[model samples]
Target chain A: MGIAYPIAKVKGESADRIYGVKGFPSAALVDASGRVIWSGHPSSVPRGEIEKALEGTAFLPRLEGKAYKKVDKLIVSREYGKAHAEVLKGLQKDSADETLQGAQVSIEALLEKMQGAANAAVEGQDFGVALDTYSQIEKLFKGHEAAKLAKADAKAVEKNPAAKDEIAAWKKMVKADETQFEGDFEKAGKLYAAIAKKYPETKSGERAQAFLSRHHM
Target chain B: MKLLGLALALGAVLSGPRAAKVEVGDLAPEIYGEWYLSDASSLEEVRGRVILLDFWRTW
Candidate 1:
């Protein structure tokens, strides 16, 4: 998952300060030579004003409820999309120059491959594999337009931290010992039913219902 | 205006019946073998009068 952000440059200063904007991911400042100076989470900063303080522009996209089956997946996807968008935007400015043709071609190819992977992940039903592929795509594309699409779809529902806690609890149950797992399936079934009842529009809720439909028989 | 009205009436008349009649717990048509944990052997050609269809996945 990508968490780093672009650093805003200050003239006449040796060090660049990194500040995170809420609803986006963390980032670090990179000098003209691509050297990192500082980094932190974007959520710590103010909600929507961080973009104005930057010498260069970078915006972190927020997480969405519908896409978040688990908290980690949502956070990781949003962060990666933010970082990729910043880098891709920067690459486009220099890509047209004759001297940078070779580097530009490689970057463009990587961006295409990553976009393909992300699309595949979006279509995939298996959450784990889809997330894994989407993460790789974010790394590959770095800053393509598709990254923006992904970012927009994932920007709402970061208001509550309760979902994160619920995710942690759910992860513990899924990773419990085999004996415990077997006994807990009955409990898990009820939990799934409740989730389906509460969030019927979400994929997680649909999956919970599917589990019941299959297992209860 | 009259021709447009007539066309709209014909369109509605042509395309309205679209609801499903059959649902779950209805008498299902007969299908083949059981798909579960146990494997079938060639030694005995087993057959049964009643068939139960169950859908499942191995998470």
Candidate 2:
């Protein structure tokens, strides 16, 4: 059946692995900000819940007891970035809750780790890795002072001509893969060939060349 | 006494740590895979729009 809404195939069993979805017909209503406002069997998700979440007025349950337990698991797994976001969303529901104070400490530690990695990459002259790590920090911690600094650092790395060209070529390769996934073989083939022609020495270009040759293009 | 032990065991299994059940107020995990009938896209690509994620499989 054709779908009017945007749809994506979950990579491998990622849905099951990441979201704990155990069966088919599962669904989640994620807000524009990427936070899931409701999740369960599709039919159990109310239309009003979706509307309220979109309006930023949905009543969120307190993050205590069971919810705190859930957050703790994420912390132990070192999914601190996710834990921080989840805790922040919980704070929005109940800003005065004292349990969230503990969560904040873990979030701070994770941010420090991320910053350390970015700094080390810069010291090693791995501008691309530094830029990527900083961009991730900016996205995950938007509006934070650290995220602001990350954006600045990423821009500085991009200022280097070699780094800029490398990033540009990598983006084109990603676009080519996207095109192939969309089932436009002809367009994808041409994009791949272009990368192979223009950036033959790069890893992505080498991959493109291999794909074209294997596919007899 | 045996029934009480079984009940406790079941409770532990049910409440034990597992992948957190995604629910309201949690961030949607990024989804990546092959696209069907459209250009490959991502949640970040459609950040401003309301998304209805339809999870289906053709058996």
Candidate 3:
């Protein structure tokens, strides 16, 4: 049976855990802003609720009405830079458009999401990841708040006493991941084991252990 | 506002692994679908659209 409306078959319980779905065949209605509006079994969802919730929300990336297919597609492609440019053009025409404003906010949210990761890495004492993620944000999101935050975080990481070793291990982990992605599991496995052993208490080390165990290496 | 779950965009690294038992008012968690059964690959692809996330088990 063919179904429409963006249904997906999730692989793990990550979604299930996040949504707190305690049973099978459950559902949740999510709004344009990624918030849960309503949730229940399919048949039990409120009659006019869907309409009301989706009323001002657009089917496009971050708009209120009408799908901006072209720009939306760029966003779908993760071309945030290009998508941001396109949104700026739209703003030129309709400076007060809620949709364009929403799009800009969404872009910021995405960048902020990345910044959150960097922050999390710092919390986890994963200096390598904190530095790497922050550096990437500094480069890609030059003008955004995420970029600003990343700059501060990166500086902090550089100041940490043990950053050098952690960063070196992370670089090696990056190489190992590249090798694994390139289909050299054998070498990658060895590399992971080595990193895990060398950086035993760090985030990269834990990740290496998780990877090895997950892959049965 | 958007339904974006940007993954590894910066330097193609990796991102959040999120959330808890969310009730009606909580912000929905990002989806991690190993397989996409629709035209969309990521949540961002279907942004701005209302989503009905059906959590089920293949008995």
Candidate with better DockQ, 1 vs 2: 2
- Displacement of residue A129 (Cα, Å) in model 2 is 6.0
Q: For residues A1-217, what per-residue lDDT tens digits would candidate 2 score against the true structure?
A: 6434444555445454445555566666766455566667777867786675454321122345786987776654445556677788888999987788666765676577678888897776555557767976786566567788998888887886766655666678768866654435567779989999997766567767876774567
Ranking by lDDT: 3, 2, 1
How far is A110's C-alpha from truth in model 3 (Å)? Answer: 1.8
Stretches off by above 4 angstroms in model 1 are A1-136, A143-149, A156-184, B1-59
lDDT of 3 by residue, B1-59 (tens): 23222221111111255332455643465554544445566655565667666665664
Best by DockQ: 3
Per-residue lDDT of A1-217 in model 3, one digit per residue for the tens?
5533444555545556555565555778877655577877766867586677665353335333455776787665556666777888898999997778888887767676667777888887788878877776776565545567778878878888877778778888878766653334567779999999998777778878877775566
Which candidate comes out best when scored by TM-score? 3
Q: Residue A198 CA error for candidate 3 (Å)?
A: 1.5
**Deviating ranges (above 4 Å) for candidate 3:** A1-95, A143-145, A215-217, B1-59
CAPRI quality level assigned to candidate 1 from its DockQ score: incorrect
Report the lDDT of model 2 for residue A121: 76
How well does candidate 3 match the true structure, expressed as C-alpha RMSD? 11.6
Residues A1-217, model 1: lDDT tens digits = 4412111212211111101111123322222111122234423433222222231211122324442224224223434444334334544775454323433344445455544554564454333333434444444334556555544422321222433433333333233312122334445557667666765554555655665674551
Chain A TM-scores, one per candidate? Answer: 0.28, 0.47, 0.57
Which structure is stronger by TM-score: 1 or 2?
2
Q: CAPRI band of model 3?
A: acceptable
